[model samples]
Target: MSVWDDLVGQGPVVEQLSSAAEGTSGLAHAWLFTGPPGSGRVTAARSFAAALQCEETPRGCGHCASCHQVLQGTHADVAVVRPQGLSFGVGEARELVLSSASRPTGGRWQIVLFEEAERATERAANALLKAIEEPAPQTIWLLCTPSPEDLLVTIRSRCRQVMLRTPPTAAISEFLVQRDGVDRETAEVVARASQGHISRARSLATDAEEWRRRGAVVEIPRRLTGVASAVVAAEKLYQAVKAEAKARTTELDEAETSELRHALGENAKGRMPRGTVGALKDLEKRQKSRATRSERDAFDRRLLDLASYYRDVLRLQLGAGNDLFNVDLEPELRTAARNGRPEDTVRRLNAIMQCRERVAANVHPQIAFESLTLALRTG
Candidate 1:
């Protein structure tokens, strides 16, 4: 796809990035691209970098050698750091900065783009700050995070920030249909379900299992009819979450465990340094926290999926007509709409929000989710 095509509903962002790529105002070196999860921050940054690297006679001609390489993330001068673990550690930041120090081989700029800088630890951010302050003449730094508040004030102040807004649903829908050759119906559902997140929209559209999982989540509100149902739902939900947590935690635990082993091989006979042991424990704690967060996020996405279904029910109750996003739930939605009042719909929305809040406040997922089922049952 072309550079601008991936930007979806973000006209303002596309225009600004296109202008910068066209060499307007001489292109700032340190740019901070921030937006909601689905906003095209990383996509925009890559597009801008591609345009800059393009050796096309017109430059930024998306089809040119330089542009293609940069877009494919193979450009020698472009370094993108995405987190493997939960946070970008100081070690990773140091490596990026070291790479950023080298000059571009082409006559253009050496670029480093941090895709999720909010994930960077404070010490890592400091290391990034040093590189930004003393950037090589031809080197440019692009830091992308969710918000200005995510980065340190010093880092935020130094960089030129470009904020991306939520793309309109129609824009996203039209984009998917036009560029991806996806049917209009599927595109519409994916776009609406994605809630302005392009990556998630793409996944929802292309992945069959994701759609199936969403269907499972939407069906939960109906099936939670009694105490036994609640308990069973709670058990199932806990197992789902626990399954995910175990998968994520295992990989992370293994990697850290390996790192620890490598750092202190079996050859060591003396006791480990107190500081080293402390550092290892801290890493373990952080890993566990991250695994917990990952599982929670997965659970939240499912809740949001269910919320979308209730919203559809509300839509039907309001006589909003047929093109509901959840095709499988048309029957239940129609039934709920006919039997439920507007107040009932509102109450359901509140229930969903409360469940979200409870989850965020560290209430056990099973309890919060089961309680949500009860509220939703009445509504």
Candidate 2:
């Protein structure tokens, strides 16, 4: 086994990283990893970090202690920077530069794996550019973003780019069955439904709630028979998306709050010492920001699922005959296709995309979904 095992359907990426790990060529102080969501961009960066710090031959040997530590995020010389809120500010970037400039305690590379580099603020990006421009001898920076255009051109130019493709449905299905012990049929269903998103495929196969949520989303098209039904559907969809987002972040938010309270000398009854209000407020602000981002992401996924239903209808209308994402809902899709024009399907898809843009611009979720549902109903 090797650290690259978790990276599905990325043989070329594995070859490039492995060769670099072996010090043959293509090694650089800064590396940029770009790909679509669930395409394993961060996973590739982490695996490369492990390979660079491997303790055995054929670097990234999964059995080695260094590899294990790196994979588990406990390695002394490797730091993982993940933005907790919507934006990573300049203060964090400056601190990261200072921290990463130090020599490695393990006598190897001082590696910083930065996830969602696109979320860095303008000033933060400038700070990062300076660090990348004159990195220390043993320092290596690995940045992950959805696309090269997300980052400043100068920063990207200085970094060697490693582009990862979305894993194929067959590869995702095989991985689910072999690694997660999912049944072949269920794996196949989720693999196609996920549309090349490996993480979503695994979640759908393993999590009953995730599968149910997706089912509800894909069924929205069928429920929009009238204005009243559309309005009700919009409210329900908004509530469900909000609940999922809250469920995902509530545990971590509570844990961080409790940890911070304890660190600030909170008594057993949970009363904190004096002058701790500011810090608690800051933590609360960050948590709120994180929750907002989570809710937006959940809504985006639901929108995409809705779009896939219309996509299948469009394909049927056009005689495309391609594989459908919602294979289980074939009858519903066929009915929708038979009843609606391809132009209507296209219009509904545009409405969903517009709703997504509105939400990203901080529009109220209820307003966005209500608008989207009405458009779908009319279309």
Best by TM-score: 2
Question: What is the TM-score (0 to 1) of candidate 2?
Answer: 0.98
For candidate 1, the per-residue lDDT at 7 reads: 78
Runs in model 2 lying further than 4 Å from the true structure = none
TM-score of each: 0.79, 0.98
Writing each residue's lDDT as its tens digit, candidate 1 over 113-144 gives 78888989999999889888878888998888
At residue 168, candidate 2 shows an lDDT of 86
Model 2 scores worst on lDDT over the 10 consecutive residues at 320-329
Candidate 2 lDDT tens digits, 288-359: 999988998999999988888888899999998468888888888888888889999899999999999999
How many clashes in each candidate? Answer: 1, 0
